[model samples]
Target: MQTKINKVELRNLEFDDYKELKNSMVESYPEMVGSYWREHHIEKLLSIFPEGQLVILVDGKVVGSALSLIVNENLVDKNHNYSDITGKYTFSTHNPKGDVLYGIDIFIHPNYRGLRLGRRLYDARKELCEQLNLKAIVFAGRIPNYGQHAATLTPKVYIEKVKRKELHDSVLSFQLSNDFHVIRVMKNYLEGDTDSKEFAVLLEWNNIYYDESPKLINLEKSVIRLGLVQWQMRQLNNLEALFEQCEFFVDVVSGYGSDFALFPELFAAPLMADYNHLSEADAIRELAKHSEPIRKRFQELAISYNINIITGSMPYLEKGTLYNVGFLCKRDGTSEMYSKIHVTPNEVQHWGMTGGSKIRTFDTDCGKIGIMICYDVEFPELSRLMADEGMNILFVPFLTDTQNAYTRVKHCAQARAIENECYVAIAGCVGNLPKVNNMDIQYAQSAVFTPSDFAFPSNGIKAEATTNTEMTLIVDVDLDLLKELHEHGSVRILKDRRKDLYEIKKINT
Candidate 1:
């Protein structure tokens, strides 16, 4: 005897399933009218990233489908319309090595709406993101029910109410429950979508495991602005005094809408006043104790100010050994730690500071970046390794007791910009810290340097601070210029490297 059993399965979309997929899309979006994918459309998507295209079957019948593509993400503007994102139905925007998994379409059969099929499709996308190590799952989702309230409420207010749960939207509410947030409301996003009033919301679901993944967003930004702080060495009464000063600069930089804010090395060293009577090494060890507290505070400030911060170099103690460390406190409430790879002879002799073992370039919303300390910037090999990692900007925070020491860092950093074909921003301390041993006076001339090319300033200096003054220098840089220089400039140093003869590599990860 033969028996019938129920079975449901989810799998990658295939070319033969296009007809069934089209029927399901129509049933899910009856009012969509003329907006539906054809056979070639499904063919192109599967050809590009088959893992991103999925379909669900109920007892051998296709009941739902989801189509996606990988995009550079830097080209995904919030105000972009549907045609702009989809490449006018040709899917020409698909990039094989892109960082974002873009969900171009998702729909379920009308009869299968209550089976949680939509959620299943979404979970699959998240899994794909984790497997591929992409930054996020981004898409423009329609507000289908908004057409009903279009006469009374604006799209922005409607979205706000949906978030607050005062109003319910079928598509948006489901997405929010699936951990997606609306970046902004867009106009004329789709054609012939009367139910949505031609509006959509730019939604994003960040992959939490992105940091562990290889940095894939090398060309993430086009226009990026940076803020550099020329800090003044001073004596502080307590830790709170240092906190107040740190918050002030963060506030000023964020107000200028700068994406990143840099503070000089040892900006928190003002707390050394309490340990003035101790030996220099012991005083630094005592300063290391405050590193944790200040780290937590900088993380808070980074979140509150909506700016990425390089919390200048601080003394860190591990296994009773002292190391100079700095953190990249991101506005997303995450942080990355890096240390000075090359410790200075003066530092080793006076403070017993040990060199750090690991180094890495960072991934940011604007672009890829690298961090180096005072003495580390004097070495060309370190920055070259970072350039190989696709670093677009290098931030150096230094502490110099004399003009000669400051000059060494500045010249080497500028040369790094020219040779690596990237931007380098260097900052250091100024003024005097009287009564503190080995910390009496400081010298600095904080500046932002760019690649030497026709696209940048003739002198390669984008912006500079007044010598030895406590102030902020804000400058804008176009990363696209770096791309052009790499491909078409008069002298393409990065692409023209003599790799066949000489190469640089890190011995261990």
Candidate 2:
């Protein structure tokens, strides 16, 4: 009576499924007397090796499970029994630093037996083995039909017959079909078992595709040389002068061998200076009209310099609504746009700007990176989400009119670096825009920050410009050092996160 396994979902075992898992195991193997796995054993296995446990659901009902643990090759001797490898079913021998995956148990409920659910479980184990880069999978396979042949054949002879397709023992045939070869046989592997006559066949599945070579640390891809610009504001007579100012900075930074150059938030505000005669709202609207041309010029500059450029931000008008947008232009001429997700009260009240709804990370030659405009970087959850997506660098472009505002941005940027274990580079406007009404009297100092640990700078500041100055600060950040900090630093904040207790997940509409 095989049930049709429509809508089967394979997922990691959750602690909430402990009761169902135990019930399924007891119901599926009722023939073995006194061979019940208690809840404490499952809890211990999950506490130590949760990644090795998997469960299968058919139409929203738990139907099967596969349990495994990692161990060193030395622990699995050629003649060892199941108890020696599994620590008497308590799985106390599970090792986090092991190189081989040892199968503990796999079972499918009786109602779902012949629908090939076991094959799906086995395939999952193989995938997990490859993903963890384990050298092999070793398990003691039960020979359910071996008792009938035990009087006439030895375990080795029985396995040989099974391999040659002359014998059809269910468990051995399935393992052989899945590329497992019998290493040897073990006696007294499990107690009170009519199956296998209290003997088990040792099977090994070698990962032929596993690479044993040492991984070379790529410094070229791991190190990003950054150029941070504290842009100065001035009265603009025309767009040509604005282009010249941007070109000057791009040329100078590219000449200094910067892999990526960052410009301050609202660096192009001076372009709005020419529209002072109009109302403040009208002036911002006029500024939005130049977003396209400005983006094109930035792209050209990025291509000419052969460096990635983060164009602080520009006022963009789309579908009669304005948004503050930043353009990340790469040397290859491809660009991504990040709209300001957190709009300031001033922007909403005065300019009728709306906040962006989406957040994303960009894949670049250097590494995964994220862009957060001034107010967006102040939020911890946004940066944490980016960090979860493997972002190594965060670029922030800001505009502040007072020292207090500048300090807030700087402190928050540094905090994001420390909490997320990532590099944060902040660039801002430093000079005044007397002609512009709402954007006058700028104060800023640009800085690059790293995680606060031994792997990074002691002060957490990689390079900082003089306060209230128009300057470019250049620094080289090691991305490899970030990897080390995340894994083995003073505190592994990323790895130590309690995902079961609380998680920061994105909701999709």
Candidate 3:
């Protein structure tokens, strides 16, 4: 019944024992910083920070400590900060926003754990930033190599086991859990890793005012990769395994260099799966609940990967009717939603889904891309509209029925790619999905295709997943080729179209 006691005070690491701080981390993790990298980190910090700037504190004499610095020095050269010319302007000093605080080290001692000491450290940093009038705070963490969680569930069982013992969670989780928003996941930062594979999180304390429509600067030009967090429909019964598999598919696709990503229609279907047996009106109401989380997660993924993501269709509730819609999200948090304009007759009459009114295009770091949902893609005119606007890539997220039917759809996709002279990506649900009629139907052959050239032309099929299989099909599309074909050619696919002749023939028949 006596009062609990604890001693906590903030102090600078300069006047304190550095070995004690270093030992705290090393003891918990022998190689918290590997032998070769430990010296490099210490040297780097010393070179940049002044003696008193590296703040550390003794929480009851060795409970926790942190190392931080204010990055007020001019960046080495705007261009050197990025891999491309555009970045020179994007990260330039022209930004009125001021300096940033960067945390170099944060570790809690084993003896005094579970006292929310880490949060206190973060609070101290936040207060320091506010007091100093800093514009932002940023830090780097380990790349969550959460491979094991995804291992037993994916096709890479053997490869996954080899990395089972690697530690990857501590730093990244601390940053994210403490309200730090991740800005980018860097490469080759961690020793022994060939690529820049570190997670960079930022906590912006000032209002950022920038115009010219900010785009992902593509700071690191490695093949663009995508990340798809599983789309879960909250109401479905026993879909945990399916969603887990779906997430594994996303990981595989990301690993394959597909810079942009999209999920199948109604990724929130699982959340609304329980309503599969409900009345159409009731189901629509239940489905609306899934939009916010889906948008937020997709936004996070886009920001994390520095890529574009098309959120597969979800039911957007507005003015009382559900609109089957897809959202095109960019790296900086701006997105445009495309509604399914050409809803199937069944969808309109039976399910009461409304058709969208317009066609839209998304301009990305990669290039301009368009979307046409399931039945919407069947309308040649719908795709033609995007072509007329000079879209280079077309994405189709469908929930189709049979493999044979899907083959026809695939052929349509190929024809669309050839005719529009653009890349066509078709993503579909592979396994059984709960239907409105109380039956589950398995979808077929989800694939990505491009116009073929003389060597493989018919733009070769990039990748495809089998009917009734749960997997992601990813490919690096060369948009430049699509641009070339559209510019000059023996065959001008869109330009050569015989629309008038087709109408004449139809009338004659």
Best by TM-score: 2
What candidate 1 gets wrong by more than 4 Å, as runs, is: 1-220
lDDT of 1 by residue, 1-509 (tens): 11442888999998898888888887887776756788888888888778889999988888998889899878675468878888997888888888899999988888878788889999999989978888899999999999999999999999999999999999999999887888988888887778889999999988755654354565345788898999987878889999998999999999999999999898877788789899999998999999999989999999999999999889999999899999999998999999999998988999999999997999988879999998999899999999999999999999998999898999999999999999999989999988788888999999999988889999999989999999999988888688768755879888778889999989884
Q: Report the lDDT tens digits of candidate 3 across residue range 1-509.
A: 11454556665554345556566666544444442214444544445443313333454455466666655425421212212211222222212243666555566766555667777887777766655566556655543343334434331332233234333444554555555654543433434432223222222333122122344764323233333332322235544543454445445555565667778776556555667668766776677766766677667666765557787888788888778887887867787888998877767665688888777677776656789887777777777777777687788887766767677677888888776777788777654445544224646566777777652344467666655665555565555455446534556677667777762111121
Local distance difference test scores for all models: 0.89, 0.87, 0.58
Candidate 2 residue pairs in backbone clash:
none
Give the range of the ten consecutive residues with the poorest summed lDDT in model 3. Answer: 77-86
**Superposition error at 402 for model 1 (Å):** 1.1
In terms of lDDT, the best-performing candidate is: 1
lDDT of 2 by residue, 1-509 (tens): 44454688899898888878877888888887556568788788889988899999888777899999999988887567777788777687889888889998999998878878888998899889978888899999999888889899998898888888898997889888776878878898877667789888888887644556645663236678999888989877788889999999999899999989899888888888778889878899999888899899999999999999999998988898888998999988999999899999988888889888788899887989999999898888999999999999999999999889888899999999999999999999977877788998899889999999987789998888999888899899988688768655888899889998999977663
Global fold similarity of model 2 (TM-score): 0.61
For residue 439, model 1's alpha carbon misses the true position, in angstroms, by 1.1
Clashing pairs in 1: none
Q: Higher TM-score: candidate 1 or 3?
A: 1
State the local distance difference test value for candidate 2. Answer: 0.87
Q: Which stretches of candidate 2 lie above 4 Å from their native place? A: 1-220
Q: Rank the models by lDDT, top first.
A: 1, 2, 3
